[model samples]
Target: MAIVVVGGSTRNIGKTSVVAGIIRALPEMRWTAFKITQFGHGVCSANGEPCDCETAEHTIAVSEERDALSGTDSARYLEAGAVKSFWVRTRQGQLAEAMPRIRKELAATENAIVESNSILRFLRPDVYLSVLDPATADFKDSAKLFLDRADGVLLPEGELGRPTWKGVSLRLLEGTPVFAMMPPIYVGPEVVAFVRGRLAAVAADV
Candidate 1:
């Protein structure tokens, strides 16, 4: 199965839009998409809010999204034509507890796409794309940790000029391909073509 993982430097930077765009652009992939939400530090996984409960109880939770009109990220995936979609919720550092299920799901799927930077710790996807916006200053450490592993990058429209993110240099993405994207239409024809070509090449090699 081909895995396309899409992550971003920060939240609300069009990561979901990009994932949905890809799924829409390539309807034949019949992608089983996943949107992972990790609640870090003092957050409740079951309720996604602050609670007095211990972290163990909220180790991991996975649920299939059935309603395309639910107005959730996973629902967006379904709305975009994904054959199946799931939302994985886990404690900040407890993702390992969900891997057995994740692995089994991947094994049974034809093609999969995930939206999380931390997943790189468990599996190496066929294509890993990092979506970034220099306009956003809050960069997640997980995103930075796996930035170099990105097969390609999706950036905002217009010249990026020099990025101001601390400890992140242009050198890190010196040779990786960058595709300009705009909101609401995060994945354009050119980017779609690039992804299709890359996946096709991967299939040919197999």
Candidate 2:
């Protein structure tokens, strides 16, 4: 099975939309989609109290159509015609604790698409696409850590404008294989074809 991971420099950067778009475009792949979320400290659950939880003991949640019909990212996957869907939640920087379960889920599918940058540490995906918004100044350390490893990048639409955050310049990403991605939408056909062709090559290499 081939695994494709879609990640971005920060949140709200169209990573989910890209995954859904790919699933819609490649329905024959029978993709099993996963949307991973890592919660920060002091987040409260039931009883309205902050709790310290072990990362290893964290649950890897799965949602079929009933749970998938909602407005969550997993639901978007289902709406895009994914055969199966899952929403994995874990502690920040604790993706390793969830890798075994995640791999188990991927192993059961014909092909899997995961949406996270941290997962790159455990498994080398068939294709790794990093979505970048040159206009957004905030760049997460996770994205920076994995930037050079991306097979290709999806850049935001319009002219390549300047983006600065805390004295750092995003111009460092210039000259990468960047596909222009307009706001609030999935990537265009050129980017999708590039990804599919690259993924096919990777599969052949294996």
Candidate 3:
């Protein structure tokens, strides 16, 4: 099975839209999409709400999305034509606890598309796309840690003179393909072609 991961330098940078666009653009892949969220302290993973619980059961929660009208990121994946969609929630630095379940789902799928920079720590996907915005100043350390592994970087359509993020270097993306993306449909024709080519190449080798 082919695995593709879509991550962003920070939150609300259109990562979900990009993943959905790719799923819609390549429905023949029959993608099983995943949206991974890591909640901070005092938040319950079971429901993603503020809580004081610190139990193992409350540390990780994984649920399959069934309603396309739920207005959640995983629901958007279903609406984008993904055959299956999962939402994985875990406390900060606790994603390892959810991987067994995630791996089981991945093993049962044809093609998988996951959204998270942290998952790179566990899986080496066939294709890894990182979305970034020059306007956004907050660059998570997780994004920085895996930036060098991105197969392609997606940026805003306009010229990115200089990223506003501090202490972050673009040199990590040396030799990596960069694609310009806009809202509504973040995956452009070129991006789709690149992904298709990459997946095809992987399948050919297999």
Candidate 4:
């Protein structure tokens, strides 16, 4: 099976959109999609909502998304043609607790796509795409740490412009195949084609 991981520097930059678009664009992959979320203190990982629960026992939750119209990120995966969709939640520093379940889920799928930067800690995907918005300065530390590992990057539409993130040299992005993200879709045919080729190569090797 092939696994594709989509990650980004920060929130609301269309990482979810990119995953959904790939599922829609390549239905034959029969992708099983996962949205992994690690919530901060007092937040519920299962729902990505804030809660007062204070314990490591409540740190991890994984739930399948059944409602395509529910408007949740995992639900959007189903609506976009993923065969199965799941949301995995873990406390900010507790993703390790959820690895066994995550591994089992990926093992059962013919192909899997995960929306997470932290999951990279445990698994190396066949394709890892990072979404970046040069205009957005708030970079997640996890995303920043894994930045150079991306197979390719999806950038917001328009010029490269000045990067506001200090300590993040332009050299970090060097040699990466950067694709322009156009509006609502966020993913283009080129990105899809690159992914397809990567997966196909894996299949061929197998």
Clashes of 2: 0
Q: What is the lDDT of residue 118 in candidate 4?
A: 90
Model 1 C-alpha lDDT per residue in residues 1-206, reported as the tens digit of each score: 89999998987778999999999999999999998888767664333477543445667778899999999889999999999999888778778988999888888898999999999999988889999988777788998899889988998893466776887867778889888887767899888898898899999999
Model 3 C-alpha RMSD to native: 2.8
lDDT tens digits, residues 45-105, model 2?
A: 2112454432444444433444666887789899998999887767666667777888788
- Candidates 2 and 4 compared by lDDT, better number: 4
Candidate 4: C-alpha lDDT: 0.87
**Top-scoring candidate (lDDT):** 3
Order the candidate numbers by lDDT, best to worst: 3, 4, 1, 2
Better of 1 and 2 by TM-score: 1
On the 0 to 100 scale, the lDDT of residue 70 in model 3 is: 99
Clashes of each: 0, 0, 0, 0
Tens-digit lDDT track for model 3 on 50-126?
Answer: 85444455778888999999998899999999999998988789899999999999989999999999999999999
> What C-alpha lDDT, on a 0 to 100 scale, does residue 167 get in candidate 3?
88
At residue 107, candidate 1 shows an lDDT of 89
TM accuracy, model 3: 0.92
Q: lDDT for every model?
A: 0.86, 0.76, 0.89, 0.87
Question: How far in Å is the alpha carbon of 106 misplaced in model 2?
Answer: 1.2
